[model samples]
Target: MKNFKIVFTFVLFLLFSFSNAQKIGVVDTEYILNKLPQYKEAEARLNAQIDTWQSELQNLQAEYEKKRSAFENERVLLVGDQLKLREKEVMDLDKNIKTTTSLRFGANGEITKLRSNLVEPFQDEIYSAIRAVVDKNGLGIVLDKNKDNVISHLPRYDYTDKVLDILLKGSDKKEKTNSKGKK
Candidate 1:
């Protein structure tokens, strides 16, 4: 019985030690993406596109307003087929404006599609970098600081900068390769 108890205690100690060996890391992906110039450029381009779309939408709305006002002013003068034609024209224009707005600004719209296209690559790159960092550091679990509800953590456990380093290094390598290819 004494020998069996000693073996059981030893096994428990080993299990605890092994369990404690795994390291947990936290990464702030948003911070890393903000530091990346490529991501910033992509975001700027998306913003510009959104601005252009908003301007176009505004123009369409102004046109609709103008037509509606004109129709209201000349509504009395228009009679029979003329009145029906003018009303139909205004309704058609309003419908066109709504269609354009929905096509460009709706939930599954052009802007959302373009944003996904522009941002997905960067997100993939960041994910890859995070994976590489985790592997390199032998981290057992990694959490996104932005996504996870992390109340407190040690600075040493924060691997955001390390992930960013990997990304920046990867970019540098690509730049070097591109420059060499150009030469």
Candidate 2:
């Protein structure tokens, strides 16, 4: 009787442990970001601004090159005070070109900062949404598809679509109001 009772207790413990074992999942953030419409829009806006800045910089560079070439070609022809004045003009133009180039480069830096600022909030929101999903589902482990390397073969690997759906649904409500005011 003692042996049978001990055996029954062991089986029940095993069943309870098996039932309570954790379920885990992985999410691919890269996949989610790529699919999100808000990310696409931000990328497009940044690209457009970069294109415009590049076009302006190109035009300024062309003008600077023309000035430089003319200064070089005319240097031998001028004499005395005229040469000195021409040299001064060229120096001034060179300084102006340098200043303009620096400003344009600064704008490029600003664009990078803007991209980070825009993307960071979305990243945070997505992470929060992922956490919510994990909590609701009683997940014990949630792995980043970007960081993890040892996933050999899961029956399913991509939670990106589900995460994106959750993110977009939340964003739409808040983003629509913000966008309306901007427009």
Candidate 3:
């Protein structure tokens, strides 16, 4: 079903390209992002935050394990209320660990939220650059090279470098303006 849609889209693209005599361009966004220093920095920051969260989770897991082991060892000596209290403590710790994990790494968790926040600006910048490149070259269709559907395209139609160049130029201008303002 997906393949059929891709083929249909490709056919339509070809029809549009030939019928209108308009150019279709492709871009490798991954390549562009890798070349972007700001994206690299954002990725690094995200990774660092992930590492810290992982460490915290590990510590909680270790504590849970320790308490669980202690509870098992003292099971024979503990009375009804004492055993219940200890079991409750262990269970509470387990619950706390699960909650923490979910809050930090779940589908709608802190990591997902942070990643979206961090990457959104870069996505906007890339989109703007791609739009500018498409407009400047009068391209009717712009396909992402990263998509599996884009099987092959001519080198001439590959506008990845042009988009990256625009992004780099924009950043350079921003840096110059920033530096001038600081001085």
Runs of candidate 2 exceeding 4 Å displacement: 1-24, 80-108, 147-157, 172-183
Residue pairs of candidate 3 with colliding backbone atoms: none
Instruction: Report RMSD for candidate 2.
Output: 5.0
Ranking by TM-score: 1, 3, 2
lDDT of each: 0.92, 0.79, 0.94
lDDT: worst 10-residue window of model 1:
143-152
Error of 2 at 124 (Å): 1.7
Ranking by lDDT: 3, 1, 2
User: What CA root-mean-square deviation does each model show from the true structure?
Assistant: 2.2, 5.0, 8.9
- Flag the better candidate by lDDT, 2 or 3: 3
Candidate 1: where are CA atoms >4 Å away?
1-11, 14-21
Candidate 2 TM-score, C-alpha based = 0.68
lDDT of 2 by residue, 1-183 (tens): 999999999999999999998887788887788878878898899888878888877887777788778878988998999888878877887787677666655656666687788789778978988888887777787787887654654847455567777888887877889999899
On the 0 to 100 scale, the lDDT of residue 47 in model 3 is 99
Residue lDDT tens for model 1, 55-97: 9889988988999999999999989999999899899989998
Which scores better on lDDT, 1 or 3? 3
Query: Which pairs in model 1 have colliding backbones?
Result: none
- Residue 29 lDDT in candidate 1: 85
Worst 10 residues of 3 by lDDT: 16-25
